[model samples]
Structures are given as structure tokens and as C-alpha cells.
Target: MSQSPPARKPIIEFRGVSKSFGTQRILDGLDLKVHYGEALVIVGPSGTGKSTILRLMCGLLEPDSGEVLLGGLPLQAEQLQRKPIQVGMVFQQAALFDSLTVEENVGFLLYEHSKLPRTKIGELVREKLEMVGLDPVLARQMPAELSGGQRKRVSFARAIMEDPTVPDDETQLLLYDEPTAGLDPIASTVIENLIRSLKQRGSCDSYVVITHQETTIRSTADRILLIYQGKVRWEGQAPEIDACQDPYVRQFFDGKIDGPIQ
Candidate 1:
């Protein structure tokens, strides 16, 4: 008797995806896969469709051609309703509401979507805040009252607050779209360390981080994929970035003024 084939695990996959805006093509026949329980970092120059990939992954935008699959299934509206996957996304800028206090902002999804009492949600809010290495006192402050780093940290807390019931096998997938962009070196380090600590949380199965920062790339990536002209120019493990021989990868990682990138 013949044995059955090994089963393929569920994870995010992009199959020959292509997208265009008016006349400019953002992604062209791009194929990528993000494996479960791995930190996949996508890095490239600006305007190379890095952010677009995240949007497509989360169903914020649809590709003009090809498929975006989440958990071995197409990310269609109907499929999403039948079997929802927990996803947490952190935007480039800390997109917090100016009017709401930090606690309110963190618990906004819970407050609106669930029947949980405000006090209970507040407690959960404080929990997430602590996870991000933030003070509980900062919860009462408005967005305007906090510094850039504080705002970004609050955003992280909010993204993670919605799902508390998923089991270890059904862990949430986190996506970071330039989580440390436009912050001071110290503040950037804070976010990088937070990303580094994600595996310990046990609730997150995998993550996809899109960033161009060298430090963030080095510290957060388990595997790195370099995208250029809407295609994956180079791919390797984190330790292999410096040793990559591709001209585009060399130029980008080495910070050379002259190479094939231009």
C-alpha cells in the first residue's frame, strides 16, 4: 500500500499576483510565501510595492490578477466569514485617534464589536499596554499628550487587544508596515525589541514585517526577501543578508552609492 503525502500547513501565500494603478504597475507576477511560525521581513527601496503586499495579504486591497491566500484558502469575503483568521496590523504611522484616550483607543475594537463591559475591556487594554513595555499611567493620556514612540506603542497595544480566545494552534498573524518608521534611534530600538519578543507571547504564530531600516531588518527578520520592480530580487535567511551576491541585494544592504539599484 502507498502512503499518503505529507500535508501542507496553512500560511499566507501570494500566487503570481499583479496590481496596477491607472498606468503604473505596482506588482507584476509576484509570488511569495510566508510560512507559519516564522518572522518574514520584506525590504526594498520606496515605491517597490512592499506596503501593497501587506494590504493585499490582509484583504485591504485586491490584486488585479492572481490570488492571495490565507491559511491555504483564497481570501474571499465569503470564506473570511466562514473561517475567520485573527490578524493584527501595525501601520507605518501610529494611527491613533486624537480624541480618544490611550486606554479607549486600545480597547476600541472590543468596545464596539463585543459585549464585554468597559471595565473588563479596560483591564485587557492595560494588559496589552504592559506587553508593549508601556506604563499603565499612560492609558489615561490622549494621543497628543504622548511622544512619537508612545503613540506607536499604543498602536501596537490596540492591534493585539482584539483576540484573546484563539488557541496556540490557531494563533494570530501580525503584520507590521514599517513599525519603526520616523522615530528616533532609541524609539526605533524600542519597537525592534518589542518585535524580537513576539515569539514569547505564544499567541502569535507568524509575522510579516515590511521595513527598509537596516537595524530593523537585521534584528527582526528570520528570513528576508528583497523586492524590486514588483519582483522578489533576492531571498535569504537573516544571517545571509550581508553575504548575498545579488547586485540589488548588495547595493541595498551595503549602502553603496553605486550599484544596479539605481
Candidate 2:
């Protein structure tokens, strides 16, 4: 019998990757892969380089050694800026400018990158803001005038402003950094619901959400990778997490620092 051809390659691949700042190693010969249309959540104790993963993918930083592959090919700054394969990011602080209105912030990237008319950009902004469940009126308000939740929503809208369209059947990869941080329970719920909706309604092939909120993880992740001391030490599905026998995994999940990490 003939074996089927090897499966399609991963969308993003990190092989024997080691990253460092001088002598401080942030990623230790790490090997991880993210496939098309799979949402992967990475959680770990503080200082484990979860954010570094996003930066590497976005070309914000270069690894000290090893390779980072995008679409089964090696990556570099020049290629990332070109088009199509572009990714979206929601930073930890929601990083919105207090001086700009929601509309302007969302339209910022579109205006800079595209020759679309001013009128067309406005329409895109309104449409995306609506998709995130924000009032068009809110779009006209300055960032400072909105609640923390509203600002986060605005940031999400802005991330998608240039992201590949969220389709009904395909998965768009969104790398979110601490999306629910500093929000109240209600706001957190809204954010979680939005995450779930993205999985259900959009063509989001995958997402990597970095957060310490257990509830947020419970609601959004398909699988969890545990990073400690700047490397991934454990990984498992959400349900399997409760039964994880790895002491480090248990310690992090149970909030104990006196174990392997100590």
C-alpha cells in the first residue's frame, strides 16, 4: 500500500530556537510548531518568554540562534512586511493612543498601508467596530473617554483593521497578548465571549493568547503549553490539564512556587 504524502507543513515553526539578551536566555533551544487553523495557548510563570514568541512571529525580534519558519519557510524582516501572510496582535496594555478617537485608531494602519480613499477607510472602521460590538458613536469618542473594556475592544478592532478578513469557514491567526488583563469580571466575560465567537464564526486558523487569567484560559484555549524558566516544560489539552502529573505543571496551576521551579 502507498503511504499518503506527508501532511501539509505548519504555518509557523520554531526549531532548536534559542533566544537571549546577553547572557540571559529567554528561549532555550525551543522547538514548537503551530499549524494552520489551530488555536494554541501558552501559559507559564512570569519571565518565561511567552511574549517573545509573538515578537519572533511578528519580526519584532530576532533570535540569538536557531530558526523561525513562517509557512514552512525561513523568516526574515523583509518578507514579513510584504503582504498576505501578515498577522494581527493585541498587546498586553491594549496600547491605544489617548489622543485618537476609536475610528482614527482603527483606521490608522489602513490609512498608512493602503491607498483606499478616506471615505472607504471610514466605512471599514465602522464595520469592524460593529463586529466587535461597539457602538459607532463610541467610535467617535477618544480613547480616554471609553472604559477599559471599550479600549481593549478598540485595540482588537484595530488589530483586525489590516488582518486578513475573518471568514465564516477559515481560521485567521490572531496573536493576543494578555487580552483580559486589568478588566473587571464582566469585561473579562465579554472578551472571553468574543474569543469564543472568533473561533466559532471566523476563519481563525489559530491564536496564541498570553494571559494569567485562569478563567480566560478555560474559556479560550484548545490546548495549553506550560513554559517555565524561559522554556516550554509541559503541554496538554485543556481537560487533561487538571490531571497533569508533571510537578511543574501542577505547581503553576495550583499557584505554588516551592516545587521544581524553586
Candidate 3:
């Protein structure tokens, strides 16, 4: 008999993780996993802890109870210095520094931490800009001058930036919080496609995106997770979304007020 394929390992895992603010519990004994080399989209109503999950993954927040693991190891404050794996986050608002030029913003981490010369960093920034379909000349322009879509693309370029000097420091996972928010349908499509294309280009091994847009959820996810009332209410492949019978899934996709979501 043929042997079964080896089990896939999760790049990120949450085990009985819980968090709260005052009396409001955002996550309660939640368990989730992001498998290697897959695109995972998280969809939910506002204030349901989707963004909080991204913050936890990126080390911006600590769970009140339970654990957040990276590459099968528990994530701890002291171990952050060693950086077992680099995790990059693209904020929902683009979050560019208004005073900085596109090049400065894209290469901010390297400029602050790497010993590389400015010229080399500039070249790397330009390369990433082109990869995101932005003009190289725009590197000199301030973030204030770019359109919303352009700013988001610039953020994408920044998230994928890596230091060539550190061989193991490549970004292993990317977290996007509402990446295509506040854009026209056409612009949102562009951002959504870029999210997939970057994975195809091997910029990051895996990515987790938090988006409520229907088109974004459909276009970018290999798998989908729906969070509700501080837990994962539904999980399935993207193709299975339409056929999913879960009340939370139905309420969310159908925009109905009479279901379990509210």
C-alpha cells in the first residue's frame, strides 16, 4: 500500500489563545493554524477581533491566556531578538510616513538597522517598487503625493523588503489588515491580484489577510476563516464558501440580519 503524504506543518498556530480589554473578551480559547505556503483570508464583522489576530501574529500584542506559536515554537518577548522568522505586516491604511519619500518609507527598516550604503538600499527599493507595478521615479516622491492605490502598493513593496546581508532574515510570513480597503472596485482588484502575485513570486512563503470585501475574499484566499463572537465560526476552502451552510457564513455572505452573526 502507498504511504500517506506527510502532514503539513503550520507556519503560525494559536492554541487556546484568549485576549480581552476590560470586560470585553475579544478572543476566547481560540485555536487556529496557518499552513505553510497557503493564502488564508479572515473575514468577519467589525470589532470581532480580526485585526487583533494580525497584531498577535506580528508581536504587537500578547494573548491574555494560552499561546501564540511561530514555526511550532512558542512566541516570547525575549526570543524576539533572535527573530526565528521575519513577519511583515501591511496596515489597512497604508500607514506611510507622511513626511518621508516613497524610497525612504520602503527601505525604513533596512536604513535603520542595516549597515548597507544608501545607494544599494535605493536600488533595492526601486526593484521592489517595480515588482509592485509602481514607477521607479516615484521613489523620490513623498507619500502625500501618491494616490491611495499607489500608497498601498508602496506599502506592499515595503513589506517584502529584506536585508541581503542576513541570509535567514527573509520574511517568512506576511500579514495584511484590510489591504484593499477604501478603494474603487478596479483598484481593489489590482491590490488583490498583487497579493496573489507576490506569493507566486516567492516574496513570502505564506500570508494571512484580513478583509471584509467580498471580491477580496474570493480573489485572494486559498482558504477562508470566519471569526465570530471571539472564535472561528467557520473554516473552508474558497470554493466551498458559496456552498457553506454555517449560519455565520450564511449571515455574513448574504448580509442578512436574522442569522447568528448579529
Candidate 4:
């Protein structure tokens, strides 16, 4: 008989991770993994450390205890600077610099870090803009001039921008924190489709999305993780969510007022 193929290591892993802020605890002994090419969605009640998890994964906030590994190595600020697998984040509010034009914002990383000429950076910026369904001409417009959906698309373009010269500096993982929070249903659907299209286009190897919108969860997740009281309380595929009997899963997804979640 042929031997089973070796298990693939996770692109991102949290081992017994815990975090606290002043007097309140956020994460407690939480363990999680994001495999390559996976679209993982995390859903939970507000203020339950969902955003905190995204911050930890991107090295903005270190865990109070336990380890966060990226590409199977411990996540460190210095390592993030040179890590072969890059990680990018799209904040809930589409945190574009208000002072910069769309082109400037999308190409900020290259402008600040690389020695590439301005014309080359401009070409890459327009390419990414078009990829995200934005007209290249919009590159000259400021962030304040764009609508909510446009702003989100600009942020997406920014997140996926990579330097072609640095072959090792590819963005392999993207963390989205409540990407569709304030959009209307139609706009939300657009963002949702973009999320799927980005992955299918091989822009990133994997992504972790933190969202509460039922439609978003259904549209993007390959697997679902429900966090309650700082730990994973349930896990299942998108289709399994409706049939799951776990109190936290039912309470959160069904919008019920009474359950273990309270």
C-alpha cells in the first residue's frame, strides 16, 4: 500500500495563545491554525477578541502568553520585516491615509520601502487598481472623494500589492477585520465577491476573515470557527453551521437571546 501524503504545516498557527488588556482578558489559551489556500471565517459577539486575533496574526500586537507562528516560525517584529511570506491586513474601516490619493495609498509600501522608480510603481498601482475593479484614472483621486465600496476596493488593492523585484516578499496571508461591516447589502455582496475572486486569482495563499454578517460568512468561508469567552467553542464547514447544535454556534448564528453565549 502507498503511504499517506505528509501533513502540510499551517501558514499561521496560534499555540495556547492568551492576551489581556489592563483588567480584562481577551484571549485565553486559544489555539488555531490556518492552512494554505484556506478561507477561514471567525464569528463571535462584539468585544470578544475577534479584532485582537487579527492584530496578533499581523504582529501589531503580541500575545501576553503563548506563541504566534508565521510560516512555521515564531512571529517577531524583525522577522516580519524579512519574512518570505508576507501578511497584509484590511481594517474594518478601510484605513486608507486620508492625505494620500488612491494611487499613493495603494503603492505606499513600495514608495516607502523599495528603490523602484516612480513610473514603475505607478504602473503596478494601476494594474492592482484595475484588478480590484477600479478604473486606473481613480488613482489620482483622494480617499475622501471615493464612496464606501470604492474605499474598500482601494484598500484591497493596497493589501495585495507586492514588489515584483522581491520574489520572496509575496503576500501569502491576508487578515480582514470586519470587511463588510458598514456596507449596504449590494455593496456587501460586491466586497464578498472580491474576497473570493482574490483568492481564486492566487493573490494570496490563504486568508482569515473576522465578520458577523451571515451572508459574508456563507460567501467566503471554507471553514467556520466560533469564538466564545476567548476560546474556540465550535468548528464546522459553512453548510454545517445551520445544523450545528453547539450552544454558542446556535445562539450566535440564530441571533437567539438565550443560550450559553450569554
Candidate 5:
């Protein structure tokens, strides 16, 4: 008899989750799973709760109903600030502090919370910057001194930095919100390649990316999920995306103007 392969394990699970802001429901009775060693890219029209999904997973937001779980344990929103789960986030706008230098920004958590010496923190900062394909010299510069792409890269560097409080194995989930948005083709390609390279390097065991860019969707996703009207409209492997016949999936893949999306 042939043995079956082991089941894939999810680092995080959204079980019957629902979220609403006043009367506007964002996610409704959603069930989603983010597994280990995979890239799951989420795509949808504006305000379809793409970013909200990221927030829920990273514990920035709590669902009005159901639970977000880590290793089958429910995650509380307050746990995020304690760095207990070791999640890294690349925000939509990069979210750099204008007052801090690149080095300071990348090393902010370590500088504030870790007892590591300043010289050592600076070295780690340089290493992360270089890993992101940025010059270490940029570390001395401010956010305003960099281009949009550079800022995004710096944000990535910051996300990958180790939090001393969290165990090394705990830092396996990476969440990106609109990582490639508002960039030129070359810049977008850079972000795409970076995502692939990070996967290749095993920088994180799993990544969840929220993006609207087609190139990003094609390049970064091992699997794809389409959210529409507070639900998962479709989901499949990246290559299967084009052949999916669901009307919403078809409309999104073809960039159609007249569809249920609107």
C-alpha cells in the first residue's frame, strides 16, 4: 500500500470570522487558512477587506465573531504588542517614521527592547538593508531622502529583523499589505523578485500578501484567494487562476469593467 503524504499545517487559521465597522461589514463568516512554507496572495477590488485580513492575522484587529488561531490557540489582539507571536508586517505605505534615520527605523524594535549594544544593532541594520538590495550607506539617510521603492525595501528590511523577545522559530509568518503598489514597472519587478528571493532563502516559513497588481499576483503567489463582498469568492493554485470559471474570478483575471466586482 502507498503511504499518503502528511497534511499541510497552517500557522494561522481564521475560523468563521466576521468583522464590521459600524454598519459596514468587512469580512463575513470567513474561513481561511495560511499554511507553512507557502505564499498566499489575496486580491480583490478596493475595500473588499484585503487589508483587513492581514490585520486579523497579525492581531491588529479582532473579529466581531469567531476566532483567529495560531497553532490552534486563539490569538488575542493584545498579544501582538507583546511580540509573543513574532509577526512581521510591511505596511501599505511603508509606514516609516519621518524622524528616524533608515538605520534607526530598521533597528527600532531592537534598540528599544533588546539589550544588544548599539554597534551590534547597527551591523544587523546594515545586513538587513543589504539583504533588501539596498546600499548600507542609505542607513544614515532619512525616509524623505529615499525614493518610493527604496522606502518599501527599507520597510522589508525592518520586518525581517529578529525580535529578541520572541524565539527564532516563532518568527515564521510575514504579512505584506500592498507591497508593490504605486511603483514603476521596474520597481514592481524588484518587489516581485524580492518576494521570490525571500521564499527561496526561507526567510519566513509562510507569507500572506495583499496586493492588486497583476504582476505581483502572478509572481508572489503559490496560491491565490479572491475576496469579494465580504467573502472568499474563489481560491486555487497560481497556475489554475487563469482557468477558473467563477464569474468573479474571470472578471478579476481579465480586468473586466462590467462584473459583480462593481
Candidate 6:
């Protein structure tokens, strides 16, 4: 007897997603699939539409022609409900409220979303900060007073505070936008190590990290997807990146000046 077709399981799927600004296209027919518990790193030149991907995932931006499906569900205009479907985001700038204290910032989501008392949220916030290797005493400090790395780490703590799970699958995804963009070598390494640890938290939680640093790229990524000229030219394991045959991937990986990319 003939067997039935196998079922398809996907935590997130981008189908022919394309985006444009004014007249210029940023993403063209970009199709990507992110499974649960997979760490996918997207690397490319400055204007290669890397950030667009994250925006699309969060419904902050929509594809001009295609669609973004979360948990097999398409995100429409009204369907863009800010419901916490187990997703968290960490922006490069730390994007914390300078006016708010660290504890308040970390508890922002919990305070607003949960019916829990402020004291409970505050306790949870402090716990989250400590989990990121920061002292709970830093909670009363302001963002401006912290160093760049500390600020980023604090923001990461905030991102996960709403999560209630670090490396776990309570959330389907964690979107990182240039998580290591403007830091010194040591700070960058710290962030990279945090990314690795996040993966260990759960077997069902996956990540999409947008970065340009080679070390950041090499350390956190299990798979690499190269976006060139608004298109994904190639993809594979991080260790296999140097051996990739695509000129765009090769030029970027080897830090070359002259290639088909330029």
C-alpha cells in the first residue's frame, strides 16, 4: 500500500518575502525557514537587507509582495496583534529607556503585560539581570551610567525577562539586530558567549542573529546565510563558510575588496 505524505513542521517560515524602500529593493524574493532550536545567522554587507529580515519577522515591516508566516500563520495588517507568541528581540543600541531605572526597564513588559503586582515584577526583573551575570544592585542604576557592554547585557536581560526562559523553548524565537555592532573586542566576546549560552537554555527555542563581525559570526552561528544584493546567495554551516564556492560569500568571508560583490 502507498504511504501518505509526510507532515511539515515549522516554527517560522518566510515565503518569497520581498521588500523595497521608495524605488530601491532591499529584499528580493527572500525565502527562509527557521526551525525550532536552530541558530541561524544572517551575514552580508552593510546595505544587504539584513535588518529588514528581523523587522519582517516581528511584523514591524511587511513584504511588498510576499508573506511572513509565524507558527504556520500569516501575519496580516490587523493580525499584527502584539501578542507574545513566544518571541523576544534585542536591538544593537540597547534601546533602553534612558529615563527609566534598570529594574524598571527590565520589568517594562512584565509590568505592562502581566496582572502581577509591581513587587513581583521587580523581583522577576532582578532575577533576570542576575542570570545575565549582572548584579541585582545594578537594577537601580540608569542606562547612561552603564558602559556600552553593560547596557547591551542589561537590554539582553530585559529581552529575556519577558521571556521567563533563557535558552528554552517557551518562546519560539529570539531576534537579534546587530547584537555586536559597536563594541570593543572584549565586550563583543562577552555578547557572543551570551548568545551561545542562550542556545543551551532550550532545545525548542531558535534564534536569528544579524551581525557583521567575523568573530561574532563565527562563534554564535550554527548555520550561515549570506545575503548579497537583496538576495540570499548561499547558506551552510559556519565552519564550511570559508570553503564556500560563491564569490560573494568568499569575498565577504576573506574580507576582499574586489569581487563580484562590489
Over the full model, what C-alpha lDDT does candidate 1 score relative to the true structure? 0.86
Worst 10 residues of 5 by lDDT: 77-86
What ranges in model 4 sit over 4 Å off? 1-5, 77-81, 168-171
Per-model lDDT: 0.86, 0.81, 0.92, 0.93, 0.88, 0.82
Q: Give candidate 3's total backbone clashes.
A: 0
* Model 3 agreement with the true structure over 112-163: per-residue lDDT tens digits: 9999999999999999999999999999999989999999999999999999
Worst 10 residues of 4 by lDDT: 77-86
Model with the higher TM-score, candidate 2 or 5: 5
TM-score of each: 0.93, 0.91, 0.95, 0.96, 0.93, 0.90
Q: List the residue pairs that clash in candidate 2.
A: 37-205, 38-205, 170-203, 171-203, 171-204, 171-205, 172-203, 172-204, 172-205
RMSD of each: 2.3, 2.8, 1.9, 1.6, 2.5, 3.3
Model number with the top lDDT = 4
lDDT of 6 by residue, 15-89 (tens): 888899999899988899888668899999988899889988877888898878887788663256543356678
Q: Evaluate model 2: give its lDDT.
A: 0.81
Q: In candidate 5, residue 105 scores what lDDT? A: 100
**3 or 6, greater by lDDT:** 3
Q: After superposition, how far is residue 245 of candidate 1 from its true place, in Å?
A: 2.0
Tens digits of per-residue lDDT for model 4 on 1-262? 9999988778899999999999899999999999998999999999889999999999899999999988788999437467678888999999999999999999999999999999999999999999999999999999999999999999999999998888754548989999999999999999999999999999888999999999999999999999988999999999998788888888898899999877
Candidate 1 Cα deviation (angstroms), residue 238 = 2.2
* lDDT tens per residue, model 5, 1-262: 9999988557789999999998999999999998878799999999989999999887788899988987557787436444345678999999999999999999999999898999999999999999999999999999999999999999999998985545765646889999998999999999999988876886777899999898899989999999998899898877887777889988988989988889
Deviation from native of the Cα of residue 143 in model 5, angstroms = 0.4
